[model samples]
Target: MTTLAPTEPLPRFAVFGAGAVGSYYGAMLARAGVPVVLIGRPAHVQAMRAHGLRLQTADFDERIAVHADTDAAAVAGADVVLVCVKSGDTEAAGAALHPHLGPQTAVLSLQNGVDNAERLARVLGRPVVPVVVYVAAGLEGPGHVRHHGRGDLVLAPFPQAARVQAALARAGVPTTVSDAVPQALWTKLVVNCAFNALSAITARPYGWLWAQAGVPEMLRQVVRECVAVAAADGIALDAAALDADVERIAHSMATQMSSTARDLLRGHPTEVDHLNGHVVARAHAHGLQAPVNHALQTLVHLLEQGRGA
Candidate 1:
């Protein structure tokens, strides 16, 4: 539980899987004068290396210069590593980072799915903090990240949680260290289970989906199913609060499409298997039924298979 002194230098950050989410945060930190290195795809790395990362938001559009590389070895001297890869790549990302991480490097899982931190920790044989990310962003091109709305993070308490929070705060990234992180993660999971598949299946945004006939009720059913599964797994979720958050998302990010929707549109594999599919599996493991979640998961799988489109 060590803390950074006020006179201490800023921690160096390395963002692995520098896609939309990673690029956004790394750009923010780099804009604030913190040293950041983004390790990502060759196209993105080349673009960033040549022109820098272009961060487009409602407030500003600017290209922030930051170190960019396609090699995992770029993480060697980083003090903090943010893992933002898709859930399917969590293990591989960890394995790739294993040899590069220094003894004092703190790893944070900024991806979706509650089990990612646990899985990554097992892979790295070190404690990995789990962060619940709430942001609406997408990649417009190789080096460009378009911010739709809201960029905040909720993290479970750990030894380096305060330090990480402090670094992000300096970069103007809103962050919280919450004792109820498991509950928060479950709440976020419930929202994803409710909206991601529906948005992807319909290729619609949150406001439109919520405005559709019976969509609100369907969302409720999905949330209820997720709550039951979470309760069985010993996490109590406030359904009313979750519903309120769903409404907030609908209003605030009305124009933003779910990441799954974007993925399907790009002909890329969606993380539906980690979102709704995870719920369905957990429900089954608990001898419970989550029909709505199962149906959504099935539909998304079909779409992924190029059947439903």
Candidate 2:
């Protein structure tokens, strides 16, 4: 893959959150000679500004220079804005950048929830493309990101999608733009709903969770409820295929903690609400009940009650 040459003028890219996902993509883009600026938490911004962003993956570990700031104004001249904040921060992040977003700037939500793009669009008064993120990463430290697994994205087809996909591909970020993004998002959500809560609650990895007795049945029920909700929401999920996919995920990242698990471990609020809670809400909207999902969401809430995000 060929990336933009240093001498070539390319579109400016801005990442709104410097968490693992944001840092990884921004660092990769910068590695490809793209002009990338990052806006996020103070410590991360300070670390990045002082030295550079540290990227650690199984294949490679290196530091790459990329502009970072705590100020939203950093997004002013960006041609593309990547929204990588947690689901709870979608609106706040969008509002923070609203006044600075140029009309031509394309927004992409690389968040967990299925509705983040829709929520961001409403807040920004513009369209925001949804991307199904398939990566396992975490903020190892300030300005440092550890990528544990996959680094690819599945995006919805749009006018600018080809350009974005090409740019990402050249940056060594595998991407696929297709019309089936809605289903793809739900599929990923299903996987999260099945594993995130269990892993987070138990403070264990996928293998540990799936090894427990009765765990398979429990995960199956969660997947069933999620599939029902997805079906109600106009996407018919294939049970067998989804289960197989989840199994593959569990095996592939057997030792990795879920994002929810990492959030809780770090004393930050988890996004179980957007994961299982979304299923509960939509299930209620459709005159259905998702007891398993409701229970998971409630458990996470209880676990996070005295904790601050």
Candidate 3:
């Protein structure tokens, strides 16, 4: 991991997918005077290029100057490229952007899923930072991103991370770099594994989901399975801390249905494979059973297929 001097210039930003999360971050950075380009679908690109990117957040509704393009080549001159595509598209997106990445360019996997950075790294043949996104956002329309609440970043430690952190802080996005980011990612994954599937299956919010009879027991089962898998994978999480973290999600965003639920509702692909599905695979490798996670993944797949049918 390399550290940079405090006085260095901020890197230019490119967002590979100008969807909800990507557009919000790119627009925020662009508003802060960091050059930002967003690559996405043609309609979104044209809409944003013509009318600028519309940001509707809890605090403000503003339009910002961000270059929106459909061309992957737009990432060519960027010093930092954020891979914001859906988890399933990580490899293909990395491949598409590979020819444009310079030796000095830094790529960050800003999408969900714990393994996206590693998957993208395999395709890009470089170290890509894994960013744990703490924001809730949705795309309301073409070129418009509606930010529900919260926008802080927990970044994995990397050679250029501190410099990136400082620049993001200057851009008003709270940034924290941590050596224990894998732990943090697993922590988020555990929460998601417990909540996302139920939210999708029932189309209910966390608070409502938790209040239902048997829901809490189901969550405990899910968490227990996840904890067993994590331990078998050699992660050092204690029981007390894990429960507290799980409780925090119920307390904080209790009204939230996961982005996966929303994705399913909108007919977009959900990231179950990266969430609970990852747990199932890890359990297999560890000689442990993850029946709860396996059931959740299987259930979500069935729901998706039912919707398709």
> Which candidate gets the maximum lDDT versus the true structure?
1
What TM-score, over all chains together, does every model reach? 0.95, 0.96, 0.94
| C-alpha lDDT values of all predictions | 0.91, 0.88, 0.86
Ranking by TM-score: 2, 1, 3
Q: What local lDDT does model 2 show for residue 167?
A: 78
Model 1 TM-score is 0.95
Backbone collision tally, model 1: 0
- Write down the lDDT that model 3 would get: 0.86
lDDT of 3 by residue, 52-156 (tens): 999998778998878889999999988889889988999899889999999999899998777899999999899999998889888888889988888998888
Tens digit of per-residue lDDT, candidate 2, span 1-309: 334456655778899987999999999999887788999899999999888999998989999998999999999999889999999999999899999999999899999989999999999999999999988788888989988878999888777676677678767899887789899999989999999988888889998787889887888899899999999999989998888887787787788778898888788988998999999999999999999889988888877875664
- RMSD to native, candidate 2: 1.8
lDDT of 1 by residue, 1-309 (tens): 334587988899999999999999999999998899999999999999999999999999999998999999999999999999999999999999999999999999999887899999999999998898989789999999998878999888877677777889888899988888888888889988888999999999999999999998888888899999999999998888888888888887788789999899988888988888888899899999999999999999889899433
RMSD of each: 2.0, 1.8, 2.3
